[model samples]
Target: MFELTAALIVFLFPLAYSPGPGNMFFAANGARFGFAATLPASVGYHVATLLVTLAIGFGFETTLQRSPILFQVIKWAGSAYVLYLAWKLFRAHAIDKVGEARPAGMWGGAVLLLLNPKAYVIIALMFSQFLEVAASSGEVIAVGWISSVFTLNNLVAFTVWTLVGGQIAGLFRDEAQAHLLNRVFGSVLALVALWMMFG
Candidate 1:
């Protein structure tokens, strides 16, 4: 139990804190919407991630590690989505134009997770690492526990990011700065999407 806990904490801390598409989105949204407004999206993003990651941990990761074609297909798919999101964001209206209003809620967060490449990669790597670690103990329970820890920690980490984003929201009082922030974030998302697809 101790080993599993330690391993999970170690793996997830770096994984969650590292810059990724999801984190970037959180930052962007936070800057635009405020942390409280982004909470639902943050929660949704983690939940959706939990679903996809569990799937990967149990099945998809191993399959992809084995099949080059399958791996490439998913990679390309992820990349394509990122590019699509980028185009959409590039076209999205600037954030500052709104009259002291928050954007739409958690649904947007869910959508962002579904579109995020960094989320996928984080899951894939965790799956692989946990599987490797679990080999020594020959225990499925350890795997389950570790996965749960990772999931919970992921939620916490994302929430923290959203809070940071919310803090950023306070920095810009005008529409122009907000719009610039949005475009920058959008560009970053597109770049991440490209990495997911082709890299």
Candidate 2:
């Protein structure tokens, strides 16, 4: 099954490594806060990714396939939520105490997982490509393995992105630089939100 594992990694690499919602969210948090501070949100997101992806692999794939409008509704709601987050970041202070300009935390991560349309679509596509079309002999085991791989891949991507953001933030030498960086991150998040909404 090394072939299957290798194929799965190859398929997941672009999706996981690219700057999607999860990566962007963590990057913004890591830029504003610190890497350690974003841990709760990361843990929450990855855990939910495992659970949600497994559920989709097992049965929820058909439900999403049948309800196209429902996906649109979720897309709008999630985009709005991410936009709100961007607004908050836009108003963020340059150098604040802990919890003043707080991170998204666990609930935000979980909510993003449920609302983010790309997430559902990606999981569904992965299942269709790997589980449905290819015809695995052991579906239960395969689904579980797929879920784990997806979660682990995402965790690594988020970690790297968070570190990248942290490094950018580290380059700030003064309040002015920090403020500029904060606004830049906010703009990036806003653009990402809009793309998710309309793109």
Q: For residue 125, give model 2's deviation from the true position in Å.
A: 1.0
Give, for candidate 2, the lowest lDDT window spanning 10 residues.
93-102
149-186 in candidate 2: lDDT tens per residue?
A: 88898899999999998888888737788878778888
- Candidate 2: C-alpha RMSD after superposition: 1.6
Clashes of each: 1, 0
User: Residue 41 lDDT in model 2?
Assistant: 91
Candidates' RMSD to native: 3.4, 1.6
Give me the overall lDDT of model 1.
Answer: 0.68
Runs in model 1 with CA error above 4 Å?
A: 65-67, 92-96, 99-121, 132-140
Residue-by-residue lDDT tens digits, candidate 1, 47-161: 7766776677667666756887765665666567656656655555556565544553567666666655556667777766777766676546655665678778877777777
lDDT (CA) per prediction: 0.68, 0.84
